[model samples]
Target: MIFFIILGAVFAAVFLLTLFFSMPAFQKNAPASSLGKLSFFDTKGKKHHPNPTFVERIVLPIFRKFLSIFRKFLPRNLVESVSKRLELAGIQDNVKVDVFLGIKFFMPFVFLLALFFISIFFKVPTTLKMILILLVPVSYIFPDYYLKSKTAKRQEGIRKSLPNALDLLTISVEAGLGFDMALYKVAENIKGTLGEEFKRVIKEMEIGLSRKEALRNLTKRTDVTDLNTFILSIIQADIFGISIGKVLRIQAGEMRIKRRQAAEEKGMKAPVKLVFPTILFLLPALMIIVVGPAILSIMDILKVMGQ
Candidate 1:
């Protein structure tokens, strides 16, 4: 009976969320068109939109109306923060801040409601009950955590890749290409978060942003220390009429040193990271395995003496 209730709650939630996700598909209640857009290209460069899916046609309009009731409660600053984080995570193209915020706002309550139903229908143990209570907050912030993790990983990749890109840029410049041409070369060859960033910078500059302004925007988007420092050096080099190749070479060396230092730091911390697991999990299990038979034999001898 408890299983049935929990399963029903899950299915109901999934059905509602499906409509909610498909809300992007509906026109004018237009997030509906997002998922159910059936957007496709006919050969010869033409596009077509199929009619909305049944869920979008029927349930999602009602679901959007239901979703709006909660949107009022997401504060302005919170929404702005979410938007900024989404951009940082590079997911702003795919996810609307409003939709993400709404999901974050409602998920915890939905979970608590389901758990409430389960508890009332079934006698949940105290330990499990406490764990469920703890998990509610985790469930609420999980999206935020995911975005943060993505942004951090992107920054780390940028940090590690900067030196190689700078070396390429420096080599290209030394090989007689202009700085802009060298940057294009690096973008052509480099791949990863840093390469993507270089591509964005090139596009920004092509679209009439001055080199200084575009590089500044690159720093704003990434916030990687070495990249920012390299940008700063380039900007100053431009201001003072220094050679960009020289700046690139210098920055490449410094970034390489920083990357090596970061690797060494991680190596230094590995033992510290391992210490807790070694003591708490491994030592206890090993001690029990090694001493168990001896202790059992001692207990048997003591029992025989008592007899």
Candidate 2:
């Protein structure tokens, strides 16, 4: 139709115009005239001369505005919850939970939209129509289950690594470095859950918080049983002016023993856990393979005798 043709032409024209206007911005290398200097156009169509880094000119503003809009819609309470969760997970720096919550909010809409399209395509049964609706919201939230599992695993790793990190800290402290410097040194050398917590603790100390207060905050954020005990030990040692090295060495040995005990418990449970699967699945298959031919031969003999 003439109307369709005109609409297509208009769309093509708009697309070309957009591509033309945007091409200069997408160029990998700046124009020869602007070599060693940065240039950008302002929103008002005026050429404002300013030095801009490649990321500042190309990426940061776009990402910043996107995050700003996203944050505007995210609930503060949800952000707080995410922040707390991240803190417990030992990720403390350069992340905003509002961004995460915004993604969470958007994910449900996207999943629902996908479900709507799938329901239309498949002509899903009326009896199961409710499942499709439920699946949309459920799938959206499914990622949180994965996130929680990862966080738990990371926390466990941190808990297991804490004693070693603490011993190193105690050594560094006893070797003439201040507690804060020792924390930094340990954080630098170690790479795990406890290392991340120590890194944040060091950052806090650098910002003027006392060593004890920072360690206490770390304990609160982690909520790990072993970490709590370790912090208490540190606090007590500080209060009594006892040598930290002795306390740390004892704690580390105890933690290693606990790790060994946990491993032994898991080994003990493995056989019991495997028994059900072996009985239910493998045993039946084995019995069928062993007795099947014998049963067939017995039936054949009986048939021959009757004949």
In candidate 2, stretches whose alpha carbon ends up further than 4 angstroms from where it belongs are: 1-75, 90-95, 113-131, 167-185, 299-307
Error of 1 at 205 (Å): 2.0
For each candidate, the alpha-carbon lDDT, in order, equals 0.71, 0.64
Q: Local error of candidate 2 at 305, Å?
A: 5.0
Model 2 clash count equals: 0
Off by over 4 Å in 1: 1-5, 12-74, 112-135, 285-307
Tell me model 2's lDDT, rounded to 2 decimals: 0.64
TM agreement with the true structure for every prediction: 0.73, 0.65
| Residue lDDT tens for model 2, 1-307 | 3334334534543443343223232222211222112113212344556996665586545644676677767678866777777555444422334334544555556545545555656654565557546655764575466457656876687777876787687788779887667878998898765675676676666667888998898787678898888889989999999887788777777877888898899999999999999999999999999999999999999999999
Top candidate (lDDT): 1
